[model samples]
Target: MRITTKKLVLCALMTAIVFLITFTPFLQIPSPMTQGYYNIGDAAIMIAAILLGRKVGFIAGGIGSLLADVVTGYYIYAPATLIVKGIEGYIIGAIANKKNGVPSRLRQAVAVTAGGLEMVLGYFIYQATVIRMINPTLGMASIIADIPGNLIQGAISAVLALVFLTVLYRTNTVKNLLR
Candidate 1:
């Protein structure tokens, strides 16, 4: 596909936005036991995935999430962020591309599922590889403890994405840009 300046700018803008949102409370937080950390950045990634297709979505999500990690000094999570966010975007975009139903609902569901997977997988990778080496068997508890948080994040992101998309769909700016 021929890349347009508009698409490139759109991708970069959303990536930076996601990175900033990752620092905000509306985004995921770092803690072993905190359940229900809502990540608004995931919604941004999901929106990009739904609108821009898988390749673009994955690039945006991966880069944005990595930048967030760097800016936040969460280097331990950077590798996982890159891989997991890319997967999340690809998963959501793939499902949306195949959808033949209530596209909005399908997009929400797909995005949430993708976000959940990203959190869970990322936590597992980061803990097992980095955290657990320092404290053995701790990774297991870390994974288990994150289940609720991942679920909560997923649910919140889904709702937020749905609402945001609904509003954006109504606007001529998003309609022209996203479509």
Candidate 2:
């Protein structure tokens, strides 16, 4: 697909939205398990994917999350966050926007589930391997401790995305946005 000015603007807007939502002081809930904090940025990422499609989703999610990590001083996890969140956004958009028009509820559900699982697994693997390698002092126990928080984050993100999508659809916002 050819890139247009409109698409570029939308992607930039979405990226800013994701970063702002993620880094907002009140929105970030500090995780008791690890240095990571849970935020609703994933909700915006998923919504962007479902609305704008995969390419925009990947770019916005990856860069936005990367910026959030850097600004938040989680430098160690920035690379992993970029890859993981990028893939998560791509997966959601690819599945949810597979067809031409607005996605069916089943498709949206599957997309969110698959994307959320990808995020959870991606972070788990990243923390288990790369994080362990970088800081051997952080043991497996700490890695395991992070799972529940990630799972909760993913679940919350999924719910928020679905509810937002439902509202957009009901209000015909999706129709206008797609056009």
Error of 1 at 57 (Å): 1.6
The TM-score between candidate 1 and the true structure equals 0.82
Residues 47-122 of candidate 1 have per-residue lDDT tens digits of 7877676776788888898888777777766787788888887777777773442366755676667665776677
lDDT of each: 0.71, 0.88
**Candidate 1 wrong stretches, greater than 4 Å:** 25-28, 33-38, 98-104, 137-139
Best model per TM-score: 2
lDDT of 2 by residue, 86-142 (tens): 999999999998566778989999988899899989999998899888888888898
> Going through the candidates in order, what is the number of backbone clashes in each?
0, 0
Candidate 2 wrong stretches, greater than 4 Å: none
Clashing pairs in 1: none
